[model samples]
Target chain A: MSTRSPTPVFLDTLRHVETPEGIELSLRVAGPVARVLAWSMDSLIRYGALWVLLMVLAMLGEGGMGLWLIALFLTEWFYPALFEVYAGGATPGKKALGLKVIHANGTPVDWPGALIRNLLRAVDFLPLLYGFGLVAMLCNRNFQRLGDLAAGTMVIYRDPAAAMPQLPPGRALPPPFPLNTAEQQLLIDFAERSTTLNPERQAELADLLARQTGLYGVAGVERLCAHARWLAGEPT
Target chain B: MPLETIAAELRRRNAWEATDLGMVMVRQWLGSIYAAWFTVALPLFMLLHLVCWGHWWLAPWLMWWLKPLLDRPPLYILSYALFGDPPDRRQFWRALPGLLLRRQAFAALTWRRLDVARSFTLPVTQLEGLAGKVRRQRLRDLSYPSRGAAIWLTVVGLHLEIALDFALIALVWMLTPDFIALEFFDLLDDSSQWGQLWLNVVGFCGLSLVEPFYVAAGFTLYLNRRAWLEAWDLELGFRKMAARLAPAGRVAAGLAMLALGLGLLMIPLENFAAEAPSRSNPPPPAIEESLMNPLCEQRRVREVELAQAGSSIKQALAETLKEPELHVCQVQERWRWRDDNSTESPPRSPPDPRPGQWFAATIELLLWLAVGLFIAVAGWWLWRRTPRAFTRARQRAAQSGPRLVQGRNEITIPPDAGLGDTAWRLWTEGQPREALRLLYQGSLAGLAAQHGLPVRSSATEDDCLRLAVAQLANPELLGFLRRLTRAWQAIAYAHRIPDEADARSLCLEWPRHFAAAGALPA
Candidate 1:
C-alpha cells in the first residue's frame, strides 16, 4: 500500500499487504466517520446486552448487582478486546460496518494491541468525551485513535470486489508512439473506465492531446479507442 | 457496462456542475430508455407476483433488489447507444439467461449500500474481468468514496422524489374530481387498513423515480474512481496524440511494402555462383605515410604568481594568538629543623636555578592550560543536563517510542525581574498568552542564568515544559508549570480560551512555582 501522505484528505488509501504466501492483499482503511458509525453499532449492542443481563440477573437480588458490576466491567473493557483479538479483529458493531482491525503490518492484531487500544479509551476520552481521540483520528491518515497508534493497529474495510465487465467491441489500431509500461497501462485504464465516463468527457479528454496527436476532436477519441482495443488484444 | 455512466462523468468533469445539467442530460439519455423497459416489465412482474405471493409491494422490492441483475441489459443498451452501435432489444432478452447463469447471485442481494462493496458488487466486477482477491481489492478501494457519493445521491434522489410526488399528488387533487380527493383523505385517515398499502405505493413510486439517477451516480463514481487510480485521462490523451504522431505506423507500412519490392530484386544464388566460378584473391594495396606535422597555436606569458610556502594559515594563527612569554615553577613543601620551635616562620624554600628548567616549565604550563579548558567544558556539559533530560528519561524509560523529537536546539532567555511575579502580572494585565510566554521564557532564562543550563534557540514550548518538568526539584512546582504550559499551548496554538477562574488561579499560582524553578547545579 502506498503511504497516502500529501494525497487529498478525501481519498481513502488501499494498504497493499504481501502475505506469507506471496499474494498481495489490499486492505482499505476505514475513515473516521465510518468508524464512528461502527462504534455506535457496538455501543448499541452493548446497551441491549446489559439490559438483558440486568433483567436475567434480577433473580439473585443484591448479589446480582455485584455480578452485574463484574459483567459491566467485563463488557465495557473485554467486549471490544475479545471480539478484536478472537473474532477476526472486529466487534459485532465493527463487523456490521464491514470494518476489521489489523496490525500496521497487515497481520491480525494480538492480545496486547487489542488490550492497549481498549484501555487507552479512558485517556482518549480526555477532558470531555473522546476529544483527544477525535483530534488524533482527524490528524492521523488511517483514522487511528490514540489506542491504535500505541498498539500499532489500523481498522479497514473487508469488502469483496465484483468482476469487471467485458471490454467494448472494437478493432485494434497501432499506437503512433512507443509506450512504456505505465503509459500502456493508461490506455487499458481508459478503456476499462470509459464505460463509467461520459462520451463528451472522453472526447474532451482525447482533445487535450491536440498538441501531440495532430488529430483533433473525434479522430483523437477514435484513435484512443483503437489503441485501447489493441492493448486489450482485440481484433485489428 | 453502462457507457453513459462514464459519459455523464466526462460531461460533469468538463463542466464542474451546471446545477447538475449534465446529470439531467445523462438521465434523459439513459434513464428514459431504461425506465420505459422497466415500466413495461413492472406490470407483468406485479401481476405474476400478485398471483403467486399476493402482495404488490414485493414487485418493486424485487425490481430494486434485482437491480444488479436488471442493470446488465440496460448497461449493454446504454453502452451500445453511446458507441453508436445498433440497438437490439432482442439481444437484451437473449443475454438474460446467460446473465442469470453466470453473474454473482449475492450481488443481486446488496439490499443496503453498505453491503454493496461486500457483494462482489457493481459494474467494476462485471466490466473489469478481475476476480477473487484482485477484484476484492479494487472494490475495497472504491467502496469509501463511492459510498460517500451514493449516500449524497440517494438523499438527492429521495428529496427529488418527495418534491415530484408532492407536486403530482397536489396536481391530481386539484384537477381530479372532488369525490376522489375526499376518498383519498378518508383512506389516509384509516391508516391501519391502508397504511402499509400507502407506504408500499408511495415508497415504490419514490424509489422508481429516484433509482435511475441513483444508479447513474453510483456507476459514475465507480468508473471515475478507477479512471483516477489508473490515470485513464493521461493514457487516452497520450494514445490519441501518439496516433497522430505516427511514431511507428506509416513508416512500418512503407517498410513492409519496401521489403516486398526488395524480395523481387533478389538474385538466384546457385546460378550466380556457377556463371562466375573463377575465384582469385587480390593482393594488398601499398600504404603511403605522410610526414607532415600539424601546426599548433601558442601564447607567451609572464611568470606565474605563487605564494611563499612558509606564509600559511598556521603561521598566521600563531601570529594572531600572539604566544605570550611565560614561565612555570615547581614548589615543594620543605621542612627545616626549627631550633627554638618558635612561631617565627622560616624563609619559604625557593626553586634552585637549573638549566633547561624554563623550557620544561613552559611545556608543563601548556599542559595545565589544556587540562583547565577540559575541566571547564566538562563542568558546563554536566550543568546543562536539566529537567528536560529527566523528562526524556522518564518518557523513554522502557519501550520509549522513537519519536522524531522536535526542537532539540535550546534558546537562551534573558532572566528578567522575578519569573513568577512577571508572569502573574502579565496574565492579570489580560495578556494571558504573553504571560505564559513570559513564564516559560523566564524559567528558561533562569535555567541558564542561575544554573548554567544549556538551551538551544530552536526549542519549542513543549521542549521547555519537558525540560522544566524534568529539571525542577519540587513536584508541586513541576505540576504547576506543566499545567501552565498546557494552558499556554492550548491558547497560543489551538486558540482555546482557558476558563477565567482557571486562568486567574494559574496566574496567582505561577510565581510560587516559578520561584521553585530556579534550580542550581549540584
Candidate 2:
C-alpha cells in the first residue's frame, strides 16, 4: 500500500518487491537511455560478429552461404535469450553496462520468460526501430516495454554493494542526546560526504546542530563526526 | 537555492538515474512544459516555414538548428517548478526574453548547438549565470562524471526523434485502406510540396515529444551533479535536524529553570528537617506495642484485599472466556444416506396402474438417461481440453463457499434479463445504490468474461479501471467505462447520488456498450 501512494513523498525509480520468504528486494529499474545504449552496443557486437562470419563464409562457396544464413538466424533470435538465461540475465552488452533482466517480482529471468520476451521483440519493433517499445517503456512505471510487460520481466541496473565509508579521524563520542535511527544515518552520511563539501559549507551544516552539541564551527563539525563514528560502532 | 523547498527527492544517484529523474520532472509538469513549448515553438516553426517558403527544406533545417533556443522555455519552467514555484503564464512570459537572451545564447545557438551534452550543460550557463571561460570551467567540473550519460541522452533523443517520425509514417501506412493502394514508397517520396510538408510536420511532432525529455533530463542531471558536489541532501538533512531540535532546546531551557526552582524549595525543607530535634527522640515500649498491633491489623486487611482481587480476576477470566471470538463454532452440512427403516414414510405417492402412465414413465426415464449421457460427454471433453479446469473450479469453490455460509450475499443478476432494463427498474424503484451497484458489477463481469481481462474479484474499482486501460483498445468504450467508474465511485464512496438525468443516461448507454457481450453468468 505504501508503494501505491498517489502522491509519493520521494520520486525514485527504486521498486520494492517482497519475496515469498518475506524479504524485500529493492530494484532500480533502468530507463530508456541506458537500455537504448545497451541495445546499441549489442547491435554493434552482433553486426561485427556477422561481418567477420561473412568474410570467412565468402571463402567456402555455396554451402558456407547456407551455413551463414543459419548462423544469422540463430544470432538474430536466440542470442539475447541464451545470454539472459545462462549468462546471469545479461547479454554481453548488458553485462558491460552493469544491467540484467529479472522478473517483475525481483527473481532472476528464467528460460520461459527470456524466450517469451525475446520472441515478442518483433511486436515491440513494429512501426520502426522499437518505437512502440520505447513508448511503452516511457509510459510504464517500471520502464517495462511491451515484451517485458508480457513476459513479466524488467531490466534493472545491477548495482554493486557499496562498501562502508571510512569515518573521519576523531575520538568516538556518544551523541549528546538519544538520536533516532534516521538521525544517526544522517550523521553517518554527512561524515561520509564531508570530503566533497567545502570547509565553510561543512561548518554551516554543523552549526545547525550547535544547540544540541553545545559547539560551533570546526569543533561542532568534529563533534558530529565523532557521533557518526560512534554510531558506526567505533569503540570509545 | 533552499534545498528544503526542492520538490525532488535529492540523494546521491548514478548519472543515468539522475537523467531518469529529469524524465519524472517532465512527466510531473508535462502540461506546463508543453503549454510553454507549443506557445513558443509552434509560432516559431510556422514563422521559419513562412520565411523559408521558397526553399521547402530550409524551414525544417532551420527549426532543427534552433533546438537549443526552443529548449530554454521548458527548462526555465522546470527550474522554477522544481523549487515548488511554477511560474504563472504572465510570469513565464515576462521571463521569456531574459531566458532566451542569456549571455551564452550566442554560443549555445551557434558553435555549441551541436554539443552532445547541451541539455546537461545548459543549466550551468543559464541558471548559474556563467558564460565564456567561466561557463567552460564550470561545465568541465560538472561533466567530470556525468558527461557520458549526457552524451548518451542526446544520442538516444536523436534516434528517438527519428524513430517516432518513421513510426508515425508507418502508423499512417498501416491504417490506410488496402483498396486505396497507398504505397509505403509514396509516403517516403518527399519530392512534392505536400510530401515534404508532411515529413516536416511528422519531424516536428517527434521533436516536440522528445525535446522536453532531453532538456529536462539534462537539467536534472546538472542538478544531481550539483547536489553531489555541494552535498545538498546533507545540508537539507542538517536543516531538518536543527528544526527538530529547536523546540526541544526551548523545552530543555524551561525544564532547567523549573529544576532550579524545585532545588531552592527543597533547601528550606532540608533545613526544617534538620531543626526538628523530636525526630531523633525514642518512644516508650507501650507506644511500640500499639504500633505493632496496628501493623498486624493492617497486614490482615491487606490479605483480605488480595483475596478479593484474586476472586474478582477469576470472575473476569470466566466472563472473558464467554466471548464469541475465543470459542468459535460452525454448522457444517454434509450429505448422509437416509436409513431404510425410518419411521416417516418416503414423501411419494404410490405409482398409478394405468398403461399410459407406464409409457410416460418410460419416456421420462429415457430423457433423464440422455441428459446424464450428455453431461458425461461434456465433462469428459472439458477434462480433455483443460486438465487444470478441475483445480480452478475447486479453488473458486473454496473461495466462494465460506461467503455463502457466512450470509455475505451478493447481488445476482439473472442471465436471461436485460441488464439495462433491470437497472432502470431498480432506479425507478428508488434503490439508486443497488441500481448503480448492479451496473458496476455487470460492467466488470462483462469485461472479464468477454475481453478476458484479469479482473480478479479482489481488485478494487481503481484496479479495474487500470486493467481496463491496459486491455481495452476502443477509446470510446474506455471513455464510457471511465465515466461509469467515476459515477460508481461517487455513489459508493462519497454517497453522492447521481442526478436523475445522469442516472437515466447511464442506464440507456449501458446496453449500447455491453449488450453485445451478453449478461454475466449469475
Candidate 3:
C-alpha cells in the first residue's frame, strides 16, 4: 500500500503507531540476523522434540516411522505459523529472542499472513538452505523474505525488556526547543547512553547543545543534562 | 553586506561533526538521489542485463550487491548540497562516475553488517577522510548510534523494497489484462525460465525504486550521527543567532571602543606626571644633579658647537669604527634527478620497503585508494557510456533516435528528421517544443505541397488562408492548419495549452492530412 508513490520515502524500522485510544506505541523491526537466530533456536527446539518423541514411540515398533512422519509434517509445516498466530506473534524461539511477527502497520499478525509467510518456507529453501529467501532478506530493507512480502507482514523486536534508565542526580530543566518525537527519542537515548560516556565526553556533548539553551561551557552541559533528566521524567 | 556578494555560495563552515540534522540533510538531498537512482543507475543496470548472456541471474544479483555503490553517490551529492553547491542535472551526470560506488563495492557485499553500516561508513570514509587508526577510532565513536539506525534503515528499506517490488510485478501483471485471464494464466507457468526471469526483472525494477530511498535514509542517519557528534543543531542555531545580531554587535563594539578612547583622552597630564626631579636633592657633582632630574633628562644643559677647524668629539667617536656593508644571495643548484618525478637513489633504485614501512605508508595508502577509486569510476563510466561506444549500434540508434528510455517504452525519433518525420520524432522523444514545431511545420508543408496554397516560411496562418483559402477549399485541412497554428502560437508565445481534445484530434488527423497532401503514404 505504501508503494504508490514513485518518489521513494525513507521508512524506518522504528514504527510509531497510535491506538484507537490515542496511545502511541513504538515498534522496532527485527533484521534478518536476529530473525535467523530466533529461527535457529526454534529449529533446535523442534529437533529436540522430534528426537524425544521418536525415542518414546520406538517402543511401538513399525508404527513409529508412520507416526513420526505425521509428526514431522505437522511440526515442520504448522509449528511456526500456529504459534505466531496464537501466541502473541512469536514462536518459542522468537519469544526467546524478544522478537515477534506483526503487520507492516504494527498491528498483531493475522492468521492468513502467518500461514502464507510460513507456507513460503519451501520457496525460501529452494536449491538449498533457504537460498532465495536469504537473498530476498539481504536485498530488502526490512529483511523480509519472499513470504513476508506476499503476506504484507514484518517481524519486529518486541519492546526492550530493560527498565527506563535512572537519570543521575541533577536539577531538572525543560528542553529549550519543542522536541518532536525523534528529538524526544534522541534526548531519552542520550540520557540512557550517558552513563557509559566518560564525564569529559558527556560534558563535551552537553556543551555542544549549549548554544540552543543560551548557556555556555559547564553551565550549558549541566543544563542540557538537566533537560535530558526532565525529558526522561526522572525525579530531581 | 557579507552574504549578499556570495549569497548562494554562503555556508557556515563546520567541522565534520557540526552538520545539520540528519533529516534536514536527507530532505535536502532526497529528490536528487531518487532522480539519479532511476535516471542514472536503473537504465545502466537494464543495459547491463541486456548485454549479459546465459547467466541471467548475474545481473540481478550483481544489482543486489551493487546498490552499496549508489550509497556513495548520495553522500557525494549530499556533501555538495550541504555546502550550498547542489549539482544540477548535467553536473550530477558529469560527477557521477568518480563518486559512484568507488571503492567499497566488494566489501559492501561481503560484510555481514556492511549493509547496516553503510550510512556510518559514508561519513567515516567520505566526510572525515580519516584513515588507518584515526579512521577506526572515528568509526568506533560513530558506530553504535549509526549502526542502530542503520539496521532500522536496512530493515525498513528492505521491507519497503519488497512491498514495492511486489507492487511493480502486480502492476505489470495487471497492465496486461490477458495475463490475468484464467486460460492464459494456466497456460503460462510462472516457474518457467523466461517467466521467472521476467518476474525477477520486475522485482529488480521494484528494488531499484526503493533503493535510492534506502540510501537516502542511511545518509540521513549518517548526517544525524554527525550532527550528534558535532552538535550541529547548536552550531547552526548559534550561527543563525550571530548572523541576526551582527549589525548590533558591530555598533556595540564601536561604542565600547569610542568610550575607552574618550576616557583615555580625558585624563589630566599632571596626574600622569613624571617622577619628581628635585626630591630633596641639592646640586652635587657637575652632571649628577642633571641625571637625577626629570626636567634635565629631557632638556639640554650645555650646547657644544662644531667649529669649521676642528671636528666634533661625537663625530670623531663614530669614525673610530668603520661600518661594514652587508650582502646576501640565495643559492640554488639542480642535480641530475632534481627535475624528475621518480623516487630513486642510485643504480639500486628505490629501496625495498619493509613490512613496517608498508603500514606507515600514508602516501602509498592514499595512492592505492585513489587507484581503486579511479577503477571504480572507470567502471561506472563504462557502465553509462559503453553502449554508445559501439559504432554499429550508434548508427542504428541514429535512425531510431535516442535509445535512452524512462520506462518500458523504447520510443525514439529519427536522427535525420524531415517535416512529418520530425514531428513524429519530437512526439516520440517527448520533446513538446521540437515535437510541436515539427507538428506545425509538417502541417504547413502539407498545406503547401498537397494543396496549391501559397504558404511561405514567413507567412502567417492568416496570410496563407487569405492567399489561397479559395484555391484550397478543403475546410478540414484549413481548419486543421488554423487550429495547429493557434496551438503552436499559444504554446510558442503565450505558453498556454490549447483545448486538449482539439490538439489531440489535430495530431490524430495529422497522418490523414499528410497523406492527402501527399506528404506521407496513406
Which one wins on TM-score?
2
Which regions in candidate 2 have their CA more than 4 angstroms from the true location?
A1-9, B249-522
* CAPRI grade of model 3: incorrect
Considering summed lDDT, which 10 consecutive residues are worst modelled in model 3 chain B? B300-309
**Model 1 C-alpha lDDT per residue in residues A73-158, reported as the tens digit of each score:** 99999999999999999999888767899998898999999999999988776533464665575456566889999999989876
Residue-level lDDT for A98 in candidate 2? 80
Those runs of model 3 whose alpha carbons end farther than 4 Å from true positions after fitting are A1-17, A28-62, A102-155, A170-214, A226-236, B1-71, B74-88, B100-123, B143-522
Q: Of the candidates shown, which would achieve the greatest lDDT relative to the real structure? A: 2
lDDT of 1 at B487: 77
How far residue B164's Cα lies from its native spot in candidate 2, in Å, is: 1.8
Clash number for each model: 33, 0, 9
DockQ of each: 0.04, 0.23, 0.02
lDDT tens readout by residue for model 2, B1-522: 767768888877888888878877777777899888998899988998889886777888999888888899999888887776778888888888887786577888888888888888888878888877887798888888888888988988999999998988898899899999899879988899888888889889999989999999999889889889888888888788877767868676566555465445334433433444232333333222324443333322332333445588534533443355532222223333676433343445665679788899999999999999999999999887895986686567544421221112454664223877888899999999888888777776667656766665566788889988988898988988888888888988899998988888888888887777543455
- Per-residue lDDT of A75-170 in model 2, one digit per residue for the tens? 999999999999999999898878899999998999999999999999999887788998898788889999999999999999887888788787
The per-prediction i-RMS, to one decimal, reads 17.6, 6.5, 12.5
Error of 3 at B280 (Å): 99
